[model samples]
Target: MGCMQKCEMSLGFESGSVTSDQISCSNQEQYTGWYSSWMPTKARLNNQGFGCAWLSKFNDQYQWIQIDLREVGVVSGILTQGRCDADEWITKYSVQYRTMETLNWIYYKDQTGNNRVFYGNSDRSSTVQNLLRPPIVARYIRLLPLGWHTRIAMRMDLLMCMNKCT
Candidate 1:
């Protein structure tokens, strides 16, 4: 039987340890409008009307953003923030990881089965945190947005355990 992995509430986010600087998205706005291509950065959290990655209004059709950690590290937690301008945030999302550059992606699922969706956040200003107990080692982390309130927009950061990273 698969062991259920509950979200550990006591584990807090570790700041100033993330090593991901490369970011990529599935859909991005490229018109001469407000949406700029250089909006998405490796920043910890971006506020609305600021430096947030904006995905095309595709309505959660295979939309995602990936972070390259450069090296394998023990990921203890994740922090996600919505556009700070309005009350829009990712409602349901899933996480995937791969240790090597040529390996297949693995879903970070729970014990019962594949945790299809993770309830991210409700408020824009509030940052949603997911703590991993018995942290997993990964070199690449991808944030897949399955559902959102209005449009898909986000800023992500990983709470990396540098000492345990291998």
Candidate 2:
């Protein structure tokens, strides 16, 4: 949670394997299709459209992009990048998730029992990855931006914890 790092395997945000429908966000806030840009589906790792993949409208902590994994999985890390043509990215974030739709959401906590804060990117284009020591297991994962550089614009990929059989 301290270092902005990287991991090898990704849960397919860049490759479009997760599909646009799986990725969504809250608080879009009346900005409907500004030139058909910045759609929730474009929020993928290494994806650059006009400038960035997804440009979040609001500049608040409550704004979040949630990814429904479709089923429960072990998420070990997350990769983040700033806007392609601008200085916009999430600098810090916290995670919340729930296994079932009807159950209450649980925050990924640290050893101190507080919401674990994961550090994000500083400049645009640099991929910063944070490994979850106690990997999260859930069907729904929400990346809530706690801080940012200019705005909460980002391209991301989720890391699924997988073991290779030898």
Q: Write the per-residue lDDT of candidate 2 for residues 1-166, one digit (tens) a residue.
A: 2443333468898887898779888755554868247866777888876845677878887788889999998888889888888888889999999999899989999999999999999898889989888788899999899999878888999998665543
The regions of model 1 sitting more than 4 angstroms off are 1-21, 28-33, 46-49, 53-57, 164-166
Candidate topping TM-score: 2
The CA lDDT of each predicted structure is 0.64, 0.84
TM-scores for all predictions: 0.75, 0.89
Mark the 10 consecutive residues where model 1 has the least summed lDDT: 7-16
**How many Å off is the CA of 58 in candidate 1?**
2.6
Model 1, residue 112: what's the lDDT? 71
Stretches of candidate 2 above 4 Å error?
1-8, 29-31, 163-166
In model 1, the clashing pairs are 3-111, 48-84
- lDDT for model 2, please: 0.84
